[model samples]
Target: MSPPSQFSSLPKDLEWLILARVPKRLYPILACVSKNLLSLVRSPEIHKTRSSLGKDSVYICFMHKNDDGVGHTSHWFTLRRTKNNPSTEENQLVSVDDLTFPDHAEPMPSIIACGPEIFFISGSYVPSSTVWIFDSRTDEFRRGPSMNVEHSFKCVGLVGSKIYVVGGYRNDKIHQAESFDLKTQTWELTPSPDEERLAFSTANVSLDRKVCGFMYLAAITICYDPRDGSCEVFDLPKDRWWETGVCVMDNVLYVYYARLGLMWYDTELGLWRVVNGLDDMKKVRSVAMGEYYGKMAFLWEDSACVGCAMKEVWCRMIGLVRSEEGGIVGNAEPAQLMGSVPSGYRLQHCLSVSE
Candidate 1:
């Protein structure tokens, strides 16, 4: 397609706004249209504005074994309202065509989302600490530098342009922590957590504002401040940390337990509280948990036996809210069914991309 001069005729500020609001998938094509548009598309200010304006959709990504259960594959999908049922609030998750990860990408690799880009960090099982990055803007995948040390099932957190990965290998605990510099496209070893003796594989990490946070060994929550290069350890009321997942939203750290309930920590107050309306979820398995809009969202897996040798697995979305008294009030909206994974295949990891 030929470049259009009409966009240039518009005012510069208006053009910037229009360009930033467009879908990320169109950036590559738009960049090919004109040099000015390309410059604006690659600018840091435009991306910053786009994120602030909420102009991006949230995509939920998962890795599961293929139908035969012989090999693994990963898929990226997003929830969108069905066109025919415009009045209904229900939404459906639609997969992106050809968005699957490389066959070499193994199951349970840690996934992190930075703006429009999703980074897949796989290691140990693979040849090395392989990194695969998917940029929604181009809808393409590119390889990144291998980590200095091999690790897998590690907890990841993003602080500024660097993504910190910790505790993938038990034997390498003393030096398992590493940071990936997005600007330089390289990995550098960082200081291990305060308590490296604890099993790092079981812990979960997230970034709250500028501080890098981690929930480790069930009772300890570590906060690493990059600005001052300081680390603080906080004791949790609960003796054991759940494997459900951990995420940061609105500057708060949320940790979910598969059996008990969802617990959240207030960074400013330094206190933890259990979300109130989750009695029904105590028995169900939590596949993944993350933030949707401003509410707490989780992917739940339900199992049932229908007189068959194997059980049936179901997946659904649940949104929780916090009341004034620090209780989980109720669902922010009706739970939506997102369909189930194939038999013998289970959800390994879940992350949301705002692009």
Candidate 2:
């Protein structure tokens, strides 16, 4: 007979509470304990319990340049709470996990999250129109169907279960939008935008859990909705088209205007305004923004001199509060140093995911 099991005698409710607190990386070990334990670890209720109890761990996905600065490598690091300083809830990035990404994924990989899975679409330097889907639960990578056309510096959006890819550099003059069905693993061309654009800067979320892909076209910001096939245009206020950083939180689009502080756009009202805080970030470099722990967070590198190429990168979490007069204002906390990267390595992108 098999050795007596420790968790076997525990009540199911107590078992869930205990296993839910375990790190996601150790789920495989727990699954081997017993069939009942494996069921608990894989159950949807276990993750829901962790999320409801504020125990969800946040993972940051990014890529680092190789030694020669000619190649890029992708990785995932968990921002875990420090055990030595357990009093505060501050998070520090740990080492990279065992999860592997597509070989030679571009320095900037276009990605989208659908449920517990993350789809890594083609990047700027990648040639093939292939897509890689990552299952966070299983911690495995699987190749998905390829797109009809190769895209670089394009925008990707997720609506319901399908993924939409917008304008990018392509040889074909059609310049049409293409979407992939997650269930069917098939690609189909969608309605094309009026303008035959060449490139897009960034894609962000816009309203009510919907993905609104944003791209800087000429001097205008094109907000494309994949669900309804609608597009909205917003005029930019600066000439630094390529230097701007954009992210979305609470249904508002936050655009980090180059050297002009952060600006916000309300898609519903079609209004733009300069945010109150974060005016001092004008000198920051390589700024990237994302949503973190129910707040808007940004990661950026400090300005560096010619001889000093490697600079310390910092992350700050900002809270947005609505004024009684209907204006949106931002308040920020102290910036936390996220460690420094070498001269050849660059902080390509930063995204926050809860598990």
lDDT leader: 2
- Report the Cα RMSD per candidate: 8.4, 9.0
Query: What C-alpha lDDT does candidate 2 achieve relative to the native structure?
Result: 0.64
Clashes of each: 2, 0
Candidate 2 TM-score to native: 0.70
Colliding residue pairs in candidate 1: 218-241, 276-328
In angstroms, the error of model 1 at 248 is 1.8
Clash pairs for candidate 2? none
The C-alpha stretches of model 1 lying farther than 4 A from their native spots are 1-77, 83-88, 103-107, 124-127, 148-153, 167-173, 183-192, 197-199, 209-219, 227-230, 235-242, 276-283, 304-331
TM-scores for all candidates: the values are: 0.66, 0.70
What is the per-residue lDDT of model 2 for residues 1-355, given as tens digits with 9 covering 90 to 100? Answer: 2232766677777777777667554565667777877787766567545644545444555566676868667656555455575335475766556556665545566777654577888756544487888776677889888889777767677655578787676565534678888779799987765544324546545454334544455556665665455666667665464332677655576777566677787656777787876665545656677665446676776746666867666778777877787778787888888776655454544445545
Error of 1 at 108 (Å): 3.8
